[model samples]
Target: MTAAPRPKLSVILAAYNCADFVERSIRSALDQQGLSIEIVAVNDCSSDGTLAVLQAIAREEPRLRVIDSRKNLGPSGARNLAFDHAAGEWGAVLDADDALQPGALGPLVQIAEEREADIVAGSIRFFSHRRQEISGAVFREDAPITALGLKDFVEAARPQNREPDYGLLKPLFRIGFLRERALRYRTDIRHGEDFHFIVDALGAGARYILAREILSYIYTTRESGLSRTRVDYSRMIAETEKLARQAPYSEDPMVAKALTRRADALRMHELNVLYGDATGLPSKLKVLARSLTSSAGQRWLKTKIAKRVVH
Candidate 1:
């Protein structure tokens, strides 16, 4: 008998207590057109019916491979496990709560094949679960496909009024490149793992291409998600510090400067949190003084003062 041909793409999906949306996510991946893809889903010890749902689906779908984790391994660990089991040339990630639109994989694979890029990323369509509405695309739809380097990624990481981190825009990664470099997600970090992974890949000299026309990955916002429940300011700071110290930014003055500014913004946010909780005048004054020392702090102070004046 002839053996089955290898799939072109392997989608790593990590699910933890996402019973409500897991099935739809799997279906979306399976529904992707123009690509021979395999879905490698890891159930991260979900107490709900997530594991059962995946099992039932996998029994019928030969392309769907479900791995049940004996213990809860957060997002990073679960994805790492899926990656280990993946056998495709390219790797894509889809959160159990999110999905991939039809014809998503083909364009990405084409870009990677044509440019010989290590990573091919595109815009994401944001959908609000509560509102039942598709808000808009994250990156500009009209933007042309552009080659990106470490500097481009660092510049995108800079803190701004809008969500600055483009990590949520899931990209198709070359599996061979990642394996050769031994690149894997940091299992320690519960949040910001995607940001670190992308930065690390860029630092490792991975060729990146942004495909503006391929806006198929759907990022759905949930009120009960971990990001919405609590804000881990310290974790964000630690991730930023690691990114600042990465080899790609160390020798480059511009990238280093941008990282420093981003760090300052994170520090200012931490101080703001303290200021909001401080009850005594002396404590508030101390926070105010600290805020004045950093550029981001000064901006924050100006914004607050202007708001007060207007009110």
Candidate 2:
């Protein structure tokens, strides 16, 4: 008897109370063409029958395996567990409420193989029922595939208006590179953990590339999703402060300046979150004006206007 071959890609999906959408997410992953794929889905102690849904889907599909988490670990912890159980050369983290584009894995894997890149990210296609389509997150459709370095990533990471938020891009990683470095998402942070992970990986000298020629992921925007929740920018401030004091990020002048700007943005964002409901437009404008003083705010607003202009 011959053993089964390992899959080329392992998609680690961490689902938390997205019962209505998990099945579709799992199906999209299972339907990837031109490659053998495994869906490692972790049910993060969802009370909404998400576990049952995952189990039922798993029973019929040999490629899909569902891990029922005993406790409610956040997104980072759940994805960490899924990645540990994955049996693939390359791995990607997928959200339970979102999905992957058809035949997305082949090109990514090919690029990794040819370029020897440790991390590869592709632009996301925003999907909405009310709109034809949303804008790209990482790069425009016609943008050439570009090498993404630590400095580039940090600069683009600022809460900016015109630059692409690389944090929004879902990147595939070489399993060995991550495992060897003991790289995992930070469980302490409920927000901005993905950004933390990428920054750490890039700082560790991982060769990262942006493949924008082909859109790889489908981002399903839900009104009730966790993304709608206010970000814990205080957590971001504290965590980034720690990074700012440490090496690599602290050593480079450009990176240090960018981190300072980001920290200021986080501070401003934190204040806004605290004072969420203002009296009227005047108060809101006052708050907005205050935030715009920070470089991150200015950059974010600029790109936002640019997006409107292009579209």
Candidate 3:
């Protein structure tokens, strides 16, 4: 028997307790036109009805497949799990709480084809529960950016910029390229797994494409999953630091320097979160003491004071 045709793209979606939004999100993927797509969603041990929502959609939608995990494997683990079952040549990350903009895939796929890029990072927009566009795309561009390199990626991702963090942008990946390099999301960090994955791909010499104008990924500002948990900034720091110590990442002196700067910025974020989470006078005092005594913390304090003065 002839095999059924493969999908053009597989949406690597991992959802947790997002039952209220998961159905809408899955329908959005199903409603997409001009592309034959398959949705591979993993239910990461959600306490809510997220798994039921996924299973319900799967039973009705032939293109949608749901996997129920025995335990919570975090975002990276769940996505990695979905990817293992993907049958498409290309892949795109979709959050369970977010929906894809209509007709978004065509232009992204076009850009990838024309540019011969393995990855395509598109612009993002925001929405709310009221079905309102809370904010527009992250960039205003009439054309897409191509041939973006490691140095560019690192600098764009650096914290404290007017531009949104590049790491936050979800880019489409060529499944073959990722498989060629054995590139997969790092399960260690929850907050910055995309950044780490993209870095690994770029380091492995995959061609990068940037779509600065196409708002392909629509992000919802709902408080769930990662939003519900306290982010460990140190995980991001350690992951970046680990990359900085590796060969291809650290080989380029300038790239290595950029990684160091990024790590420092992450350290600042770590200190700020700790300070904000500190409750009693003793804990607060301890944070202040650490900031006062350490060089990295001193820089953080200086930046903190600088921002306060500026505002």
Candidate 4:
């Protein structure tokens, strides 16, 4: 008898202390129909029973490959390791707490092949585990497919925009495109790493297209997620600053404008932190004065004052 062919897509999942949700995530990937896919899961030295859970699942599911890490490599490192071991032409990221919709990979792969795109993304539905309900879709549904270049992506990521970050939308990327460009998530950044990776891919001139027709991914907003537990304003500011400075298209006028907007948002975050930490009236005044010194701070102050007056 002939052996089964290799999967066309590899779903890389970096799991850390996610024993409660990892099994469901793996099962979701395995349940994907109409496509040949493999789940490459790496347990990053999870303090919980995540490793044992993964190992047990792997024994039952042949397509699920589990890697046990000796040290805690975090999400980026684990994902990089998984990428090296993946044998698929296309790669997809699946968070341990999240799951993919049925028939997700087939349509994404078709789009990538048809357009010769390096990245093919679709809408994501945000599901609140606490509420036990899916909130809504992330991407706009008006267009069938929206093509984006580096400049366009940067602009859409601006703070003033109501649209969701394209990074939050799970994308099916060509393995060759990522390997050829040496695109990997930065291990240094704890938060906003996904955004940085997406930016880097776009900056490296990867063709990105959004398929608005299908909401293929479900992003579960769990109470245990980093966004809920971590509030490191300074680290976030530094990451955004680094992104602006190191972007390949930093010299472009449009990219520059987007960077400026991001910088302004960072400044606003700083001002908010300062104000929140102020103990007394004098301290609050000092914080306000310091915030008003910079152009971004001045705008933030004006906006705050405007809201107060309106109320």
Candidate 5:
């Protein structure tokens, strides 16, 4: 009798100067149960030992594949490179510094198979430096933001102010859905590209499935990390606005409300971080006053955009 085809899943990890953790990360992907995983890793021109580590892992594991770029393309660019090479029914965008827990992928893939879900999200267990589960909860586990019922579970997962530490973990995704929607990582988006990718996919009416199981994702909270530095305050604000504008809001009131609220919050945060002036105190206060008079929730957004022009 002929052997059956290997069960395949493409795990894409973008690494930049993550030599300390890339090996463990690769091992986590390899250790996953009941899946023939093609580990597609990209070394985004890391000055550190990231490439060597990936090469070493590739030698040990035949399934592991490494793509080396001569120049540093950011996370989105690296993932795009791997997307071209991925050959699997599902794709996962995993960070290099973080790792997946054993037994996470099998069940997640099962959800995708049964529900025919384009995107499958699972609960997260956020960890500290010591690799302990500090907290856990479903992403956007609240009303209003999560009130889109099944949709909130699919995209727009904001976990703050809900549970102890709510977050959206690694989402198992259908490769065909991404191709059909013409969705890929936005190259210009550095801070929240992953979030934007998922939302954009959902905006195109992509089917979603939520896996209720909690996955222990080891997240390192080191200061000198790529994640800490990528957030351009101005760009983050603009991307949120873009997301709000692009969403098919009329289709779902809950999604509409959540997008509006999220946009407002992004505006507020950006203004607080970047909306300052050296052009006299009075002029700044006048600008601030105009912002307040505009709208209660969206006033900050006006100020944020105006600051972008003046400063």
Candidate 6:
């Protein structure tokens, strides 16, 4: 009898101070079925017990490879390092703080191969540490997984805005596709790096398929995490403006509409933050003036004028 061949996948788990949740995240990647999985657990010089936890896990699981950095590098640097060390046919980016559901990887691999897709996305369910067994406030399911079908699914997911805020759907990617396109997370931006990365992949003519059958990711919301910080509204507004101006969807009507909606939503959220009670009078006044003087502000004004004139 012949033995089954290993389907190679490189799973990169970028860790930085995720000690409390890193174990679960690694286990999820390790649990993947029907694949020759190499887990690259890169520790970005976490001050917490993340490195120790990763070491313990690595000792237990032969597939889990730990890269403990001497100095603190951000998520982008960690991910890049992991990818550099990974030797697999496919690559999956797994956040250190998140968990993958059972039997998630096989479906994505199947869908990507069957559809000849460069990228395959699956559904995600959000959960919070505080709310035990409460499911989540938001869960998203992408379109049906058919051969070469992603336009409708992309349209449906466009307005979700923040990439990581929603797009944890699936985690199977062709390593060759990333290497060919030279797609790496941008290290400069803190808030919207994933968004920028996705746009880059899309612009590079990447093909997409949906893993519609599986719940591939479990995204956790822990209040103690970095996500709970107050936003720099002025900076975020600028980011939104840049996103609108630079998104490759300027020529695609549906995508353009979705981008516009996302821009508006982000601007509105930031505006509230700028004007919210937590802000002081001088800061509020400065932000207000900046908002009115911004390029986005000018664009908004022109759009309103054009709408009224047309109406």
TM-score of each: 0.88, 0.85, 0.89, 0.88, 0.76, 0.76
Clashes of 2: 7
What RMSD does each model have against the real structure? 3.2, 4.5, 2.6, 2.8, 6.5, 5.8
- Where is model 2 more than 4 Å wrong at Cα? 129-138, 222-230, 265-277, 281-311
Task: Compare candidates 2 and 4 on TM-score and give the better one.
Answer: 4
Instruction: Select the stronger candidate by lDDT from 2 and 3.
Output: 3
Model 2: per-residue Cα lDDT over 1-311, one tens digit each:
99989999999999888777788788888878898899998888888888888888888998988888889889999989998999999998888767888888789889877988999987787777356465555556778788988878876775643655667788999988998999999888888888899998988789998888878888876543533224677788778777877897888888887777667666755654544766788986776676676665676556556877999
Residue 58 error for model 6, in Å?
A: 0.9
Any idea what lDDT model 1 has?
A: 0.81
Clashing pairs in 5: none
For lDDT, the strongest prediction is 3
> Predictions ranked by lDDT, top down?
3, 1, 4, 2, 5, 6
Worst 10 residues of 2 by lDDT: 221-230
Regions more than 4 Å wrong, model 3 = 130-133, 222-230, 273-285, 306-311
Q: Please report, in order, the local distance difference test score of every candidate based on alpha carbons.
A: 0.81, 0.80, 0.82, 0.81, 0.68, 0.67
Better of 4 and 5 by lDDT: 4
Look at candidate 5 and tell me the lDDT of residue 291: 52
How many clashing residue pairs are found in candidate 3? 0
**lDDT winner, 2 or 6:** 2
Candidate 1 vs 3: which has more TM-score? 3
Error of 6 at 127 (Å): 1.2
Q: Candidate 3's error at 64, in angstroms? A: 0.6
190-235 per-residue lDDT for model 5 (tens digits): 7767767777776777776655444535555544253423656457
